[model samples]
Target: MAKILVVDDELGIRVSLWRALEFSGHKVTLAKDGEEGDRLFRENPTDLVITDLVMPKKEGLEFMSGLLVDFPDLKILVISGGGVKASSKDIELLLDTAQTRGAVKTFAKPFELHEILACVRDLLAADAD
Candidate 1:
């Protein structure tokens, strides 16, 4: 199983993601915000990062930028409640920025558990090369 880092400011979201990942047999790390996420990333290496788009400590895009700069091959998944469809310009920008930085997948909030699991599996499998 891949080691995953989940960064989100919402306590409920963090707990839910952690539980889901743990149930799927993946090693999971939870962070309250991007600052904590960065610190954890440095202290303990993770195979993939799953982060919320907008956060208080640091924006997810910024975190992804730094993480990608430090670890180019890093597989990342951007999750956002902001972008439901194509109309939300800010969400679109965030998604685009993350994609440019090497995020493998993007998931809109209220995402199904199966979808998240599938995305994680796909990303890790691809990384296995």
Candidate 2:
């Protein structure tokens, strides 16, 4: 099992992901926003991080950037539903930016949980290699 950190502003998303990941036999930690996520990461480095793009404190891109800066090998998966007012194009741009900034994978919100689990398994396997 891998250790995973999940960061999102939405309570429902955070709880759901935490439960799902834990159920999958991976250790899971949940954070409400990027700042808190960063703190948790620093305190207890995990095998992977799953973060939401738009948040109240220190957005996902910035948070991921910091993580990459400090831990270049850390694995990150970025997820977003886009901002309330953001267009689809804007969301795409944000996801693309996240990849360029060091997220290993990006998923638009409403993505299938199984797909995420598959990606997580793949990434962890790759890391083990």
Candidate 3:
């Protein structure tokens, strides 16, 4: 199993993802924002990171850029529900930027849990090879 870091500001999302990932046999860590996520990543260096796009204290694009600079091989999955008023185009732009920066996969909020787990498995498996 891979060590995974999940960064999001929502408590409910964090808890649900934590439960699912843990149940899948992966070691999981939670961060409330990009700053905390970066700190935890620097300290622990997990195999994969799943981060939310819209967050306080750094945001996903900036965080992913930093990670790519420091760890080019790092695996990242970017997710977002966007803001209350954000349009689909806005979300697409944000996720596109994340992909350009280095995220391996992107998911809009309310995504299938199994899909995320499958992505995690694929990324870790690729790294293992």
lDDT of 2 at 128: 81
Residue 8, candidate 3: how far off, in angstroms?
0.4
The 0-to-1 C-alpha lDDT of every candidate, in the order given, reads 0.86, 0.93, 0.91
Expressed as tens digits, the lDDT of each residue in 53-119 for candidate 1 is: 7888788988888998889888889988763454566676777777877788887776797898898
Comparing candidate 1 with candidate 3, which one achieves the higher lDDT? 3
| Clash pairs, model 2 backbone | none
Ranking by lDDT: 2, 3, 1
Candidate 2 lDDT over residue span 35-111, tens digit each: 99999999999999999999987899889999999999899999998989888899999999999898999999878
Candidates 1 and 2, the one with greater lDDT: 2
- Name the lDDT value of residue 37 in candidate 1: 98
lDDT of 3 by residue, 21-103 (tens): 99999999999999999999999999999999899998888888898899998889988988678898998888888888889
